[model samples]
Target: MSENNHAYTLSDGTSILDLPKVSLHDHLDGGLRPATIIELGSEIGLELPASDADALGAWFAEKSNSGSLVEYLKTFDLTTAVMQTSAGLERVAREFVQDLGADGVVYGEIRWAPEQHLGSGLSLDQTVEAVQSGIEQGIADVRAAGRPIRVGQLVTAMRHNDRGLEIAELAVRHRDNGVVGFDIAGPEAGFLPSKHRAAFDYLATEFFPATVHAGEADGLDSIRSALLDGRALRLGHGVRIAEDIVIERQDDENTYVTLGTLAQWVKDREIALETSPTSNLQTGAIAAWGDELIDHPFDLLYQLGFRVTVNTDNRLMSGTTLTRELSILADAFAYDRTDLEVFQLNAAASAFLPLEEREELADIISAGFEGS
Candidate 1:
């Protein structure tokens, strides 16, 4: 489906695209506009797979759909290539927020590694500042257009790199400016959260919040490390936690299951699972179960009482949005508007905002759904 198309809907025919939403796992580098990529590539003398916006977008979808993590990641080399300078970062960040607003996202956390943007001699702090300035401009532009939207930064460190502590400190340093949280991205299999012990320890000492990318490409052990070592307040696309679940039986009336300790902890603690349906399929995050969306453990996790929040891990790569993700899940699981609202509430509660602010967001979501 085209990125502009709505992939799911409410029972009463309400467009899922019109519903208020919260995007928790969106990546700043993973969501560049195709036209913007072409323009930025022209400015930087970078080669693109396709010169036209639609064809370039289709190229991203094809690469991401290859079911190879390496192939999926190769697409980002092109995106980050155009995002080295301050102007590039600011423009991309601004467009990211504007796109999220256009897709009915009321609040979002845009995560990206500053280290990746320093190829042009910009400091890590300068990169963060540029992105934040762009985010502010995007917010102003959205407000001027009579749309209400809010965005925060989740400064990310490369899990495969040795600068976790430095990045964690950078995130904390800008907590009041625009950064709201810390995260670790990149290869997730061998580079466990325990590898970044000193960084997590420093973040703990500073009482800073973190959300680790675990249980996506990796399994239960990585999730355990995220909680025990990283002290993660949330799990980024922790969809693989379903590996810990054992399904006993299923009938028309009921499905019986058992949960392992790790799954139980995630359920009891309500650590938000940033489940991205299309991205999960593309990255093989849900390959243990099946290839289709219905085969995804998202419904199983939700039924098992995990705090499941729908997300679009990479909008451009997956050819998706928060609205499209929700729509696809609803279509797969036969979910109604109430189920969709529950997912939004789950995300709002798990957001890194103050409790009162989260409550306000919940109120907005509730009102929006009610009006719909």
Candidate 2:
């Protein structure tokens, strides 16, 4: 069961929440518990649109489902406001891990932009330390509860901002700490990864990894820049890449398809697509395909071997858990345990970990699924 008790049992009565999973594209600030937000906001004398946790959660969900990426982002103003202090940031991070653990995530990468949390007096490094402290405490809490879990930070740089180089340096500086990788997130259409060339170059020189937000709020041109300019190893919410694929003809037995040049490169390289299904529908990322999850190109990408990984980009805003994400996909596609296991394995392969560790994670997942 998830933290919300969203029990998703498979056909064989195997609970999805009991399966060891890997989360590669969750956001730290986006996963805050609604009760925590109310408490933190009260402590900071912040005005919340909703006075109660349930109401606040519903409010976020309602706002995020507005079918516009711009409107979907307005809810973050409140979340970021409450996280301006070190204590708030640490507490949020700790609870975020607890929630992930409860949802059966063996490993997760929590991404957030340090620049957004600096509204208070803390410096850049201070924010990183605060989040790391919370992650350690959360890991301890999960272990104390007898569930093994591991988590790392992916420091993000808002694409609309000019702090890409500075945030990149901050991420590299804290690589030995809890920070594991780098990313650029935020309104994706107007702000191409090319604008952050200097930062990408710096990270490349340092041999650091990155996952850029593309193919969600933007098109193939944006994805091209993410690969060539940002040098991203993975793409965040890369559902739009389906736009580049052309189905020449479909018959009862075979569906002939042709991949565009850029799509072919991404597929050939096995670059992971960090796809968030519900969020994609809400943000209209897959409107070009259809308005429903069944219409999503996830199955198309998976059947064609695109290294697609499932993720919950924003839990609170979407009112979802990783468990729920998998459950919905399972329900939509009539997926069996084998299909679910494949998604988890794909995520394990794409995690920001060493080759040996990723293999170890894969072994854990395989073992867990077998027992399930």
Candidate 3:
């Protein structure tokens, strides 16, 4: 019913790569090509864990499966190391857009912390410019190849660091450029979003949008901080929000459910959950539920009418594309093309674009799916 020979396909024989998709939580530093890393690492005299591109890719995939968020995040050091220079950042950004296009992404928001890439003496603004330049080039590349694709930047601040307010200002300053949103990414357990309340408040005043990383390495209280203090429009890897739901009982054909106040608020507001299955499994975000993809609360949330969007949090580390993510979820949850279309529609609506643009995206997705 399905094939994975060269391209990903669904049970109905629809090529997943031909479907229009929108990505919400993709990380810029975490999606680099393995060959690019080797070349860039060589320029800076950095020793790689593997010599060849395929093995280096395997190395990243192997290292990221450690089942600890902290341990899984250590892989970013190698990626960020090569992304310090302007040229390096530009090239990576350019290629990232191309890769997403190839994976059938019509629109995507690439998030990264500029602070982490400042080691090469590039100012925060310079890093943003370099990335924007590459994104534009990549857009052109995709268009030239007869594919429609667009990407925006989500400038992120390190939650464990002290430059939250500064990073927020940088994100707002470039709002007209490639930047579309702001975020706080890093260890999520102790570094609550409230630690950057001032930054969130500034963003609130300027009316800049933000999506906080919460409910992944932390629990309900952290998600609460992200909503109450950070005013996050979306929750990054918010699979743990499932903890707030209490399944009272399940009959032969129906299951009774009770949602806590936090879960109710998220559902009512339609705040998106950027759920990355492989990344969640690797980071132990869904460990309490189960270790496999089926154990992910993704189905529970989606079935409960929560706004859940599939994402590739880190393509390289997870060794996954968006098509692969959707395909695996389909296999695990027995979802058909309609279900897949809904997921893409949810993502299109949740994108940081304006209402009209989001509607346009939804139209595009609907048309693509209808055609398929």
Per-residue accuracy of model 3 over 179-256 as CA lDDT, tens digit each: 999999999999999999999999999999999999999999999999999999999989999999999999898878
| lDDT on C-alpha atoms for all candidate structures | 0.92, 0.92, 0.94
Off by over 4 Å in 1: 1-3, 6-8
Where does candidate 2 clash, by residue pair?
Answer: none
Candidate 1 to native Cα RMSD, angstroms:
1.1
C-alpha TM-score for every candidate:
0.98, 0.98, 0.98
Give the range of the ten consecutive residues with the poorest summed lDDT in model 1. Answer: 1-10
Over the full model, what C-alpha lDDT does candidate 1 score relative to the true structure? Answer: 0.92
Q: What's the C-alpha lDDT at position 209 in model 1?
A: 92
Query: Which is the leading candidate under lDDT?
Result: 3
Residue 38 CA error for candidate 3 (Å)?
A: 0.5
lDDT tens digits, residue span 59-176, model 2: 8998999889989988899999988889999999999999889889999999999999988899999999999999999999999999889999999999999999999999999999
TM-score of 2: 0.98
